[model samples]
Structures are given as C-alpha cells and as structure tokens.
Target: MRKPAFHRADERRFLDERGSSGPLAPNGLNPATIMEKAVRERIVDSYFYKEQCFGVNEADIVDRVVEHVDFIGGVTGTVQKPTPFLCLAFKLLQLAPGDDVVDEYLRHGGDRFKYLRALAVFYVRLTRPDRDVYARLEPFLEDRRKLRRKGKSGTSLTYMDEFVDDLLTKDRVCSTSLWKMRRRDILEDLEILEPRVSPLGTLEDLLEEEEEEEAMQNGDDANGQGHDGDSDSVRSVSRSRSETRPRSRSKSRSRSGSERERSNHDRMDVDEPGTQRSRGGRSP
Candidate 1:
C-alpha cells in the first residue's frame, strides 16, 4: 500500500497554523491577557495621544467608561479591586462634566473635594481645584444665565466640563424620553454612587417630628388607648411628618422587582479593605 494524497493533512495544518512543526497549547492565548492588552491599546488611543490635540470627545469617553464604573460599583464584600483600566475610566468620568454621575459619587464614602479636584487637575490642567462645574464650565460660562455660582477652589473651566454638561443638558432635552429618564438605571449599578436625593431627615427635623409623635403617644397612653390606638393613625402621623419634612431627594426605588426592592443597599464591609471583621455586627 502507498501513502495516500492528503495523508497527515491535519497534523501538517496544525503545525502550519502555529508556524512551528510542534504541538502547542490548545487555547492558544490567555483571555485575561488579551483583554488587558486590548484595554491598554484603547486607553492609549483614547486619552494619551499627545500630538492629537483635542482627541476623543468627553461624552464619548464617559459612555465608554460607564461599564467599568458599573463593574466597580457592583462588586460587594470587597474594597472593589479595580483594574488599571477601571481606574483610568473612573478618572475620565470624574473629569467629564455632568452632575448626574458626580452627584451619585458624592453619596459614597470619603470627601468629594479630593476626588473631584484630582480628576479636574488631571484633565483640565487647572492650577487649583473647583468643586462645582456650574461655575467655570466653558459652555455654561459662555451663557451668563447658567452661571449659577462662582467656580469653587479657584479652579478654571476645562473643555471636559464643557463637553459633559452640554451632553447631559442636551440628553435631557433633545434625546428620546428613554435617555432623559435613564440616569437612575445607569446609577443603580455603581456601589459608591447612590441616589443623590436624601431619604433621611435633618437632626432638627427628626427631633421635631419625634417630639410630635411622642406627644401623640403620651396622650394615647394616658387615655389607656395606647395599645388600642389605630395602627393607621400611628402610621399616618409618622408618614405625614416624613412627607412634610424637607428631605434631600431620594432616588426612586423600583418596585417591579420584588427581590431587588426587598434587598437593602447596606453592606457591613464583609471581606472588605479598610475594615476589620467584627463579631458584633450582623451578617453582611
């Protein structure tokens, strides 16, 4: 018998593909490594093209980074170990104008001034820090009416802020109804970001309301009707006070998902950095 045509073709083809006459690892490349390389390339192209003046649009940059932001926010039980890409993304978003994300960021731990200033300096080349974008933001500064307050910390306007604020304002007005209402959904994924609106009352407000409730409770107790007092009445009083007291706007909670609605946002820093495990606290 003679060796037939195309005999051992599979073996030869495999060697040809590898550019070697030997076997190699079946998977060929590590996914994590590939992802890392890809992210690095994109960042260099997007943010570090020194010669390319005024490169990527700030709005576009923020949109691209939103995924990383969400990833950083969702990782619980750990002090989110963000990759360099994630860190860069965070830096970009911070520099990007738009209070939508910044407002949410303020809810997280730490002083907002430091983070905001750091990002502003990195992108805008400002000599000092400015807490409020509304003041020196390029587009807003041009429009005298929108210049609500002076720039904070003596920082000047940056192109990044101008781009972001414009994007946000435009999205609110010209974009579809969906985009206008989509901030809460986008913000939900971030761990540090919270509803900008506050659900709690001020110390004074709480005290006053509590006093009122106590008075009502005392009257009922004296009449021997404390136990028999209508549950609705008690709820009504508390709820009324809660409603009337000036509150920082709370983010709207979605009731459609029963499971999510029932879940609390609080975390005990379980397995987190900057925190020690303690027996006194309830389970995370």
Candidate 2:
C-alpha cells in the first residue's frame, strides 16, 4: 500500500472547512485567521514576557505587568476566568507596587465587570494594608449596576452590591465555605454559607408570577362578562312576559263589555210584549 501525498491544496481545503475545532489556514491566511493568530500571539507573548520578567530581577517589568493587567481587566466581560491572569500580573509586580497603577485601576475599575472588580479587590487585599483596602473598596458597596455571569445552564445577572458586601464582610470575593472541596467533607465539619442568588433568576420568577396573576385576572373578566350576558337574557325574558300579561287583561275587559250589552237588549224585548197583551184584554 502507498501512502497518499499531502499537497498545499489539501491543507487549504482543511483550513477553509469550518468545524468544532477552530479554523486554520496553512497556505493563505484569511483576515479572520490573521486576526485570531495575532490575538493568540499577543496573549502568549503577554504571559511569556511577564513570566520571563519574573525570573530576572528587572525593575522595568512593572510597566509591562500593569499594561497586561489593565488589558485583562478591560476584557473581564468576555473572559470567563480573569482572576488567574490578574493574580499572575499582581505577583509579578509584588516587589515594587505602583501607586499610579492602583489609582488608575480604582478610577477605571468601575467600568469593568464586578468579578473583575472582585479580583482587583483580592489583589488589593493581598498587596495593600488593611486600612487602605477598606478606604479604597468600601464605597463600591453602593454600586447599583448588575454583573452578568455565564454558567453551565445559562447566563445570570447579579448585583455588584452583593459582591462588594461579601468582600467587605467575609474578606473574600466569594464564599469559600460553599466550595465543592468544603462540601465533600463531613456535614458536621462544614460551615455552610449563604448561597449566591442570581438577580436574573429572581426577576424571571417574579415575571412568571406576574403572568400568572394577569391570566387569572383575564379569566375573572371573562367569567364576569359571561355572567352579565346571562343576567341580560333573563331580564329580557321577564320583560316579554310582563308585556304579554297586560295584553291578556285588555282582551278580557273587551269580552265582558260585549256580554253586558246583549243582556240589556233581551230585557227590553220581554217588557214590550207583556205591556201589549195587558192593553188588549182590558179593551174586551
């Protein structure tokens, strides 16, 4: 048996075909392919250079770490797990913590996702003093905006206030007590924390309840209309019967008047015959 010879056309066909595994072009690069490659290289270089800077005692690495951290922070909405990357960047800048970096993050951090802010809070907690952490992160508890998160089932929205509350009260962005590792232990050994509730799920439940109430109200209105129709039919039937009773009474009165006139005529005829017989007998 002879093996088939690989050709450039075959490689191009393979790259052009879209499937579960991503697109790849060997001979000619599409714009999409080029952009994807560029993004991949940037990510790889960002991590590699940061790691390389970590190995050496370099002071200029702070700028590179900060730039990468800011980039990751800005992309928190798209990236599923940004904390690991952020923690790595924080570790790289551990020796010489820049006040400008912290200030810049604090100023622009509100525009990022809440999880990103939580990760930033974790970084601050680890690096800054306790007083500075309180001073910087406490005001975020008042944020009213929601954070969207993707899960196994679907996407869910949550309040930033709740996340900030957890950070402030528990000294952690998320409750560790509810972790799978903690749950795997004996029930008695486990300290259960309040489960994080998604605002989106709650809103959905409320909307369902509202729809049910509206359906019930509509059913009641339909029943009310049916009852009103029944009442109207009954009233019309009663009115027709009342009108018929008056016509029957008038007919009865007319028949009684005719009977009285006939009796008066018969009495007059009998009196006239009696008077004539009496006059003839007296003359004879």
Candidate 3:
C-alpha cells in the first residue's frame, strides 16, 4: 500500500470525515510547526494558492506573484525557502491559473521566508535578467549566496538557476534584508554608486524634448499632401457670412426694448397726420 501524504494526513482525513470547517493545519502542526515545515518542505502551499486566486489575469499572474514576493521578502529580510516547497508551489501556481478562489482563504502570519524566496526566483525569471530589473537585482546575489552558505538553516540556492529558467517559460503563480556593512561590501564590488543625474542634461531638456515630439507629430499631419480632395465643408461654412451668423442675430430679431422705442418714434414722425418727413430725415 502507498504511504500516507506527508504531515497530518490522518487529521486531514478526519476533517474530511466530519466535514467540519475550522482552523486546520497543513499537516497536524500548529502555526510554528507549520513554519518549520516550510523550511523543510521548501514550499508554502497556502500562500501559493492565495496568490493564484487573486483575480489576476494569466498574463498578469507572474508579475503579481513577483510583486507580492517582493513586498513580503522585503519584510522578511530574505527570499529563500526549502527546495521542496519552492518546486511544489511553482508547479501548483502553473496549474491553477483558471482557479480564482484562492484569495478567499488568505490569512496573515503565514510563512514569510518560503514565499519571499519564491518571489525572488520568480522575479529573476519574469524579468529574464537581461533588462534593468535584473541589473538592479545583481546586487542581491552575494547576500543570497551567503544565505545559501549558511546551510539549510538559512535559504536554498541549489535550484535557483532552474527556478529562474522555469519562470521564463511557465505561467506560474509564485511568490531580503541584511545589514549595511555587508551591503556596502557587495555594492563596492558591483560598482553601484548612488544614482546621479549628470550635468549633461536638466529637467528643462526633458520638457523640451517632449514638446518637440508633440510638435513633430502635429507637423507631420499638417504636411501630409494626400487629403487635398477631401471636403472643406467645415472651413467653407466657417468662412462664409451666409452660413455663419453673428451671435447678435437673435437680438436683432427681438430688438431690445430701448432700440424698439427709438424705431417707433422715428416711424411715428414719418407717418404723422400733418407733417411728412422725406427719406433723408427732413420734414417736407
């Protein structure tokens, strides 16, 4: 007969038996034990599930996993888990892209180290290490190697290369800190001086460059010669007095009361009973 699944298969079996929902452990271990198991298993199943179910699209899942790992890894001070855990979580994430229900069960205080390690591996893979993100991450490798050198008590690096390569090909749901002294040493070796914007250019140059781009696009449209046969109806109407009426047209239609009074007076003088005014405004 096949041996039982690792951890609390019997308790899991019991939970299945009672059909009761409660705070169940991955095996029979309590929270601390669970964390310990993460170190050994090299994976964090629940975290993986939670990430896969976060309602992200397939294309976005890897990025989301990388982001989550970064956020958590930064908190944990390192991203290194047991190889077994990493491998399993990686496989599960790849398999569960269509299942969007994992988020419902997410809880705080889970295993941080496992997920953090997963995230770093996932990030290295997602960015493919050929771009700027990889360049930024190169600084972290010494810390990583040291962590691995600490033996199983620390993080695992054996499968890192494999994990990274797999991340490049897999649509996987996935998922450090250290002190300044060692960080400084690593930085010195990597030649990563603090970022500096050189005297070669200024913010004004950037703005001018943007303006030039926009002007060039507009000029391209204006200089194009293929539309000469197109109708000029809009321009024709705008330029024609018959088609373009002044805003005062309605005012003229309903002449203001003062102007109306003036007109009435002038008409009355012309049509008076005993006097006649010539069209030139003189009485005749």
Candidate 4:
C-alpha cells in the first residue's frame, strides 16, 4: 500500500543514524547542515518578514523550519529517521512570544493537519496558563479522525482523540496542577472542587409543593361530595315523612264520620213507641 501524504513528506528528510557519512557530533549524530540556497532565498523574500518590519516573526520562523525539513539536501538532509524540526520550531516560538504570530498560526492551522495542529498546540501550551490550556484543548479531544504514524516496519493509524490524550497527559502539553498526577488524584481533586449545591434543588422543591397542593385539592373535592351526599339523603327522608302525614289525617276523619252515623240509628229505634204497645196486647 502507498504511504499517506504526511508520512511520505515526513520521511523525505529523515536521517538514518547508521551508515551515515559525515562528521559526528557528541550526540553521535551528524550535525545539521545549512538550508538550501533556494529555500533560504525564498524565506528572505517571504511577505511574512516584510509585514513584521524585518522583526522576528514566529510563523515565518516555523514556515522556514518546515520548508527546511521538506527541502532536498537541506540541513538534516534526506534520511530515514524521525525528524526534530517541529520541536525546534516549537522551541524557537517559545523563546520569542508573539500574540499576533500565534493568532495568525491558529487561524490558518487546520485541525485536520496533525503537524500544523501540533505546532498550534505547542504554542498554546507554552504560552497559555493551565486553566486556559484545559479550556482550549479539551474540545479537540472529541475529534476522532484517523492520523497516520510511521512505525518501525509499517505505518499505523491513530485517532486524533488518542493524539490529544497523549498531548495532554503523556506529553504534559499543559502546565496544570494535575500535571504528572495519577488519574485517581485528579478525580479526587475534581470532586473536591466541584460545587456541592445543585441548581435543580429549588425546582424539585417547587414540584413537590405542587404535588401536595394537588393532593389537598383532591381531598377537598372528595369531602365536598360526601357532604353533599349526606344532605341529599336527609332531604329524601324528610320528604317521605311529610308525604305520609296528609294520608294519616284523611284516615282519622273517615273513622269519626262512621261513629256519628251509628249513634243516629240507635236513637231512631228508641223513638218508635207504637210498635212496642202492639206487641204487649198480643201477649195478654
């Protein structure tokens, strides 16, 4: 398979430690060579220097370093090892701080490009404080795009999230209080620093009060219905009694009229004296 563009470009100037023909420094590696004439001339003519009034510009310095690494037969020459041009550029920027240069680099630095992003990260880490570092770099941890890294025998893919993790923890990219601390220690510190009070507590209390009020209103409705039922039952009983009272009075009047008619018939029988005398003569 073909290597990625970045990996191919990165290896273009890598120098192999063994079988190298040159005067060795104390580090047992060949000293870096001067930049190619053409590349040097381009750097001198670049507008980056002109905009800075011939003063030192970090972006221009970084661009020169990248150009030097990419150039054929330039200082570090074409070799087969990892290059330190990025680290050198980072060091140069750190030595001379420039907000305008940093801003320009960040604005132009595409996050998809690992080298450019790495340079931006290094600039932020060296210049910004711990709090700002975490705030700024945390968002990059969510990026999951694959990046290619040259391995000993082959290339391996790594996610951007993993790269960011390495930058933050393994590489100590930012100078925070938890720098070099264990994960457990960091968690403990976070727990201690987090606020104990929650913002939802008041909302919960309000919900509970609303629920209680609903319960009370339901109970009141139930009690009101029960009272109405009792009143209805009492009215029904009184109405039945009132309806039976007129019937009882009519019955008493009919009984008194029958007794008076019986008394009048007995008086008529006593008043018939002629019939009684006729019966007495027949007996003599």
Candidate 5:
C-alpha cells in the first residue's frame, strides 16, 4: 500500500495515512508531551476535537485553519473547554507534518489568511530547535496585521508581530509553558545568528523625521502666503503713512505762519493814535 508523503516512514510516524488514533493517546513522548497534560486532556475531551479535528490530514488541517480557526487560544468558555484552534494545534503536533508543509503554511501569511499562519508559527515555536525557531519566526516580526486572541483572560485584540514575540520571549503562551529561548543578542554575539534589523528602524528617528518634515512644510506654507500676499500689504501700509503724515505736518506749519503774518499786517494798518494826531498838526 502506498502511503501519503507527509507520513514519515520512520518510527516517528504517530498517525497513519488514515489519521486513525485513540482519544488522548499519542505514539511517543516528544511533541505530545511538549504540551501540558491539562491542556492535552482538555483538547482531547473537547467536542471540536472529537467531531471536526478527527481524521484530519495535513491538507485538511489547512482547510480547518482557513475556515474554523479564528482566535488563537488554549481554552475558552467559563467551563474551560479547549478551543478548536488549540485542538488543531494538538492535531498538528500529533500528525507531525514535515518541514515543507509547515513552510507552505507560513508562506500564506500575507493577509489573506493570517490565522493559519499564526497556527504554523505556534507549531514552529514548539517543535523547531531554538535557532531555527528564531530564524523562522524573526522574519515575520514585520507583520503588523491585527489578530484576535482568546485566552483565560478573555478575548482581546493582538497583532501578528506581538503574538510571534510572545512565543519567543514569554515563558508561557496560550496556556502552555514555552521553553526558554536564548536571548537574540547572545546568539548574535556567538555568531550563531545575524543581528536583527528592525523593519521600521528606530521609532524615535522616524518621529523626529516626521516632525522635521511638518516643520519644513509649515515654513513653506508661511513663505508662500507671506511673500506674495502679506508682504505687499505691509509695504502699502507703511507707504500710505509716510506719504500722508509729512503732508499734513507741512500744511499745519503753513497755516500757522499765515496766521502770524495776518496779525502783523493788522498791527501795521492800525497806526498808534499819537502818530495820527502829529501828522494832522504838521499838515496845519
């Protein structure tokens, strides 16, 4: 009988091609044991686990990720039932898909179906070696798409980047304890990993650049209006004042001088009474 490609021929084969399995039973102690016992138990007991997740192959898992998986979480409901998302995660661990299939899952992370990519990310964090995990997951830090995450703390909004970061740095995620990962700097120091380059670069530098651009733009706007518009208005105001002020001042001085001259002419016309009498006597 020909078996499917994802089904490993080695002893590591946990599920046959038909995906036959007993409830809560795993073939070995590697990945199935990686998840906590309580979480594994809840997942196996879940109705979604019994109904939807049963007999799912690697291809079927993708369909489930696209259709059924919405929120990333370990358990939901007040009674603490395992979520369908968690059930599929356990299913992947149980089936142990090959690296190529996992890569295919990651390749679809470009906004059409982000939840599926998240599923692949969680699986990679758990299964892959620490170095591979960092190398695989670090590239996706630039993915800032929003995601809905459900947990014991209730549902909340989270970003794709934030979720991947949690898987790397946080001790526990989705109600499962994550293995401690080496610090990124330490790995870079040992020459194990290249230094991480931030996608947005330094946030402070970006803000400063934006502020400078706005300032330059405002300066340009001021110049645009002031040079052609306000400058002429200001000059006209100054010119009108200069032309009218001295003319009024000169007119006032001339009127004052004429008044003084009129006073002197009246004084000359009205001779003194003694002078008039002397002239009359001399004529006699």
Candidate 6:
C-alpha cells in the first residue's frame, strides 16, 4: 500500500479509541516537525519506539509510561539508546493525549510515580499554549521531590522542581528542543496568568530579618524592646532603611571631611619641624 507523504505508515489511528492527529502545535507545525527531524527519525527507528511504543492508545500509553519508565533521560550511550522516558514522550506526541489525559498523568502518581508526572509535564510543554504551560508548570516548582536523570555522561540527581523549571526556562531539556515560551512576567501583565508566589515568600522579608539581627548584634541596648520582648529586642533595629539611610550618608560624609582635615594638619606639623631643621643647617 502506498503511504501518504504527510503521515507515517506506523501512525494510522491504532484503535478507534484514540484519535491520533499530529500534535496541535500551537504554531501549526506538524507533530513530526515538533521534534528535530533527526531525533524524531532516531526515535521512530529505535527498538523501543518500534517494539513498545507501537499501537498504544491513550489509556495504555499511560500505563506503559508509569510502569516502564524508570530514569528520565534522552538518548544515552555511544549507540544513542533512547531512554524509555524519551520514547514515551515521543509516543505522547503521536497519541496526542487530550488535556484530561495529560492532567491525569500530572496528578497520577502524586509522589509515588514521579517519572510519569515528569513525562506529562514534558508533553505539556511541547504541546500546550504559553500561558497554560506557565500556569500549570509553575505550581510544580515547589514539588522538590528528587528525580534520577540519565544522560550520555551517566545518571545524575535532579529534582521535580528543577525539571519543571528547566521546561519553563531552558531552550533544550533532556535533549529535546523546547518551544519558545513567553516570559511569565509578560503573561502576568496581560492578566493571562497571576504572579507566582514563592514558597519561601519574598526575598525582601528575609533580608529585613537578617538586617535586624545584625543591627541588634551591633547595639541592642539602644534599640530597646518590643512586644515579643527578647525576640523583638531587635524590633526598633528593624526600622525601614529608607528612613535612616540619608542620615547615615550625611554622617559618613562629615566623618570623611574631618579625617581629611586632620590628615592635612598632621602633614603641616611634620613639615614645620623639617623646615626648621633645614633652615638651621643653611645658617651654620
């Protein structure tokens, strides 16, 4: 049978259950074009892609990903054996799992089956809209669960949060080229996304606490105590820097001027003795 130029032979809808269409590449790039052509070809030709990745529907694919995927990686070794994670990622591109399936994958393992979650987010990044990608992936920034990732160099430790972050910020991850995503701040400005709240809270608050502690160490007796008593002994020390910054600047400027004058006076005193000694020698 003559195969159509656009679709691959292996890629006819395996079962009526799955509607296999090319990735809904937001930019209209076909699914085959989503991955680099060479990499896509490699994945298609690889033993895993041929054997395991074939004929899987949305439901089966999920099982395959969770049960089979151990280490998250791209191609590893000199022969470039594709990781099961990458193979499944490519499988997702082919099956084109719907939003709900993707969500199921994201929420599926919770902490138990993390690589599945990793694969889901990877697929999401490849397929979803810019705003949705940021909104969905940013929450995982706090996941912090450890992930094992393998590569040409060998396996290394990574975290779920770090992987999610790389998906958002990096141009390439796990050897797959990521589509350019809009900046998070840009989306927030457009009101497409809300600003993400960090788990540790704003950095400014931590700096303020540290500054208060340092100031208290320098002079607790002067600042006095507050409601917390001992804990708030540094309370007065925590006054907004803006209020006292100008006064400190003025004091520093005056001190520098006085030091300069004292240096000049000392120089004059030393020169007077030298001048007297030279004058007596000339008179003799």
**TM per model?**
0.24, 0.33, 0.20, 0.34, 0.70, 0.68
Q: Which prediction has more favorable TM-score, 3 or 6?
A: 6
Q: For model 3, how does the per-residue alpha-carbon lDDT over 1-284 read when each residue is reduced to its tens digit? A: 99886533222232233224334222222222222234423343345534443334444544444444322221122455323234333333333322122221111211234344444344333322233323434333332211222222443444433433333334432331111122333544676544424344678898999999999988888766435424466567667866447656766766787688999899977666444444446635
Best-to-worst order by TM-score is: 5, 6, 4, 2, 1, 3
Better of 1 and 4 by TM-score: 4
What tens-digit string does per-residue lDDT give for candidate 5 at 152-222? 77899999999999998899888788777778888899999987768767778899999999999999998
- Per residue, candidate 1 scores C-alpha lDDT tens digits across 105-204 of 3222113222332233223211112222222232222322111111212323333334335434453211111022234335446532343332455677
lDDT of 4: 0.48
Q: What does each candidate score in C-alpha RMSD?
A: 39.5, 17.7, 20.5, 17.3, 8.0, 20.9
Candidate 6, clashing residue pairs? none
Q: Which stretches of candidate 4 lie over 4 Å from their true place?
A: 1-56, 61-85, 93-95, 111-113, 151-154, 171-284
Per-model lDDT:
0.34, 0.48, 0.38, 0.48, 0.80, 0.78
Query: What is candidate 6's CA lDDT for residue 28?
Result: 48
Error of 1 at 124 (Å): 11
Assess candidate 5 and give its lDDT: 0.80
| Tens-digit per-residue lDDT, 123-219, candidate 4 | 4554454544554556666666665544334545676567566656763321212123234335447663222233436677889989999999999
Clashes of each: 3, 0, 13, 3, 0, 0
lDDT of 3: 0.38
Residue pairs that clash (backbone atoms under 3 angstroms), model 2: none
lDDT of 1: 0.34
